[model samples]
Target: MTTDSGTRTPIRWGVLATGRIAESFASDLALVDGNELAAVGSRSPEAARTFAERFGGSRAHGSYEELAADPDVDVIYVATPHSRHLEDVMMCFEAGKAVLCEKALTMNLADAEKLVAEARSRGLFFAEAMWMRANPNIRRIAELSADGTLGTIGQVRAQLGFVGPAATARLWDPMLGASGLLDVGIYPLTFAHLILGEPVSITAGGTLSDQGIDVNGGATMTYASGAVASIAWTQVAHSDNRASVAGDVGLIEVPARFHHPTMFTHWHDDQLDTISEPVTGRGYAHEIEEVAACLRAGKTESALLPLDDTVAIMGQIETILDQLGVAAR
Candidate 1:
C-alpha cells in the first residue's frame, strides 16, 4: 500500500468546506510540495465554484458527498464547524478517503472517540489538524524539554483569546457548539500537555454568554509530577496569547500567538538563547505535508498529532465545559 521511494506523485487534496478556515488552508496548501488542491465542496454550487476557481481546484462539488467520492483526491481536509465534524468526517471515511480534520476533533469526547474508532477500523489515514504539533519551533521545544535542556519541567502557562466577532454566528451561536474553550483554549491546553503529560485534576472557572456558551475561562491543571499548568481562553477580550514552560534547570518562552510560533527563547545558566525555525505559509503547510507523507508511507495515523492525544484533549475540554455549567447539546 506504500509508494516506492522513487515514486513522486503529488497527493491530490479535496477540501470539504468553503469557509474562512478552508480558504486559509487552501492558500497554505500551495506552499507545500507534493500536494494539489484538486477539489472543493460546499452546500451551494456557486460557493464551491468560487472557491475552486480562486484556489485552482480542478473540481467543485455541490455537496460534501460528491467531494468525498472524488476519485482524483487522495485526501480530504474537513474544515467544517465543530458541530458538523463527526458527520462530515464519517462521510469521507465511507468513501475510503484519508482525512485531516479540524481540531477540537468534535464537540465532545464521545464523538471524538467514535471518529477514531471508525478511522482505525477502516485502516484510513486520519489526524486532527492540530497545526501546533506540526510546527517546527514547537517540535523543537518538545525536543529540548525531553533532551534535558529544560530539565524537570514544573510549570507551563499559555493563553489565547480575541474579542469574538459579533457578526459571526459561528462564534456566538450555541447551536454551532460555539465556546471560547473549544475555539481558543484548546491551544493552551495542548501546549501544556505537550510539555507535561495529562493532569491528575483540573480546576476551572469561566463566564457564559446569554446564549449559554462559554465566553471566557481559565483552568489550572495539576499533574502527577507535581507540575502545574495555568491556561486561559476568552472571546470577550484580547489576551497576550503567550506561552512558556519552566523547569528546574531553565525556562523556554514562546512569544505571542505561541501556538504556531516560528521562534522562541531558551533561558539557562544566566544566558538566553533564541531559537528560530522556518514555517511555511502561516504554519498550516506543515500539517498538510504530514498528511501527505503518512499516505505515501502507508501509515494510518501521525505520531506528531496522535489520535489518542486528540481524544484526551477533547476529554479535557468536556470536563472544563461541564464544570462551567455550559450544557452540552
Candidate 2:
C-alpha cells in the first residue's frame, strides 16, 4: 500500500495457528509482494516459535490472545479447524485486527451469521479465505459466465475427494466438527454456489459412518434460473476433483482439481478456447491479496466473498448434513 506521502507499506500479517494449512498459508504469504508475516500464535510456545522462525513471522506468541493483542499486526489469518474458525475470527475482531478466516467459515449457518454480524457491528474487516474465488481463472470464468459465454448455464458439476489418513481426528471426530462435509465438501458446495447462486432446492445422498460423520456425499442443487449444480465430495476415495459448467450454446470445463486450476477451457461448436492463469505459491497469495486490498481500502467485507454468501453456503452444507444425518458431536 502507498501512503499519502508516497511511502509503500506491506500489510503486517499474524497467523493464528501452526497447523499444516497454517504453514502453507504462511509460505504463500511471503510470495505476495505487499504483505509481511509479522506474527504467529499457537497454544504451544514451542510451536509458535518454530513456525515463526521458519515462516518469517518476527513475533511468536504463546497464545492466541497475545497474537490478537499485538498492535504491530494489521491482519490475522485464522487457519484453525472449521470448529475453531468462529472463535478465532471473533478473537481477532475483538482485538481490532482485520481477519481472513478459513472456510467453511463455521460449523453451522447460524454460527457463520453470528460471526459476520458481530464483525459488521464492530465495523471490522472480515472475510472467509475461499482462495478459489480470488483465482484469476475463476474470476475470468465468472466474468465470462455473466457475459453469456456459456449462455444460460443449465447444468454444473464439481467434485473434490481424497483419501487422507482415516484416523485424523479432524476428519472423523464429531467433537472437532469432523465430517468430510465441512472438511472438504465445502469446496464443491461453494463452487456450486459461485456459479449457480443459492439453491432453491437441495437434494442430497451420502454414505455416513456409524459414528455419525459423513464419509462422502453427493448433492444436486436446483436454482430458480433453471440451473442445476451437481456436487460430490468424499474422504474415502480419490476423485478427479474437476468441475464443468454447461449451457445450451457451449460448455466450460475446468480440468482436474478444478478448484485450484491453472487454467480453464471453453467449448462451442467444435471450437475450444483456453484461458491459462497459473497459480502462485500454493495459490494462497491471491486470498492474502484480497485481505490486504480490502483492508487498505478500508472495506469491512470482501466483494468477492460476501458475508451473506459465506452464510448461505453454510446453510447449504447444513441442509446436506441434516439430510445425511451427519450432525456434529
Best by lDDT: 1
Give lDDT tens digits, candidate 1, residues 185-286. 999999998888799999999999988999999999999999999999999999999999999999999999999998999999999999999998988999
Model 2: what TM-score? 0.97
Write one digit per residue (lDDT tens) for candidate 2, span 1-329. 68899887999999999998999999999999889999999999999999999988899999999999999999898989888887888888888988889887898888888998999999999888899898888887778777887778999999999996966888877778788878888987888888888889999999988788899899999999999999999999999999988988989999888888899999988899988987887889888888888888989999987888888888888899999887543
Regions more than 4 Å wrong, model 2 = 1-4
- What are the models' TM-scores? 0.98, 0.97
Q: Report the number of the highest-TM-score candidate.
A: 1
| Model 2: residue 152 alpha-carbon error in angstroms | 1.6
Clashes of each: 0, 0
Each model's lDDT: 0.93, 0.88
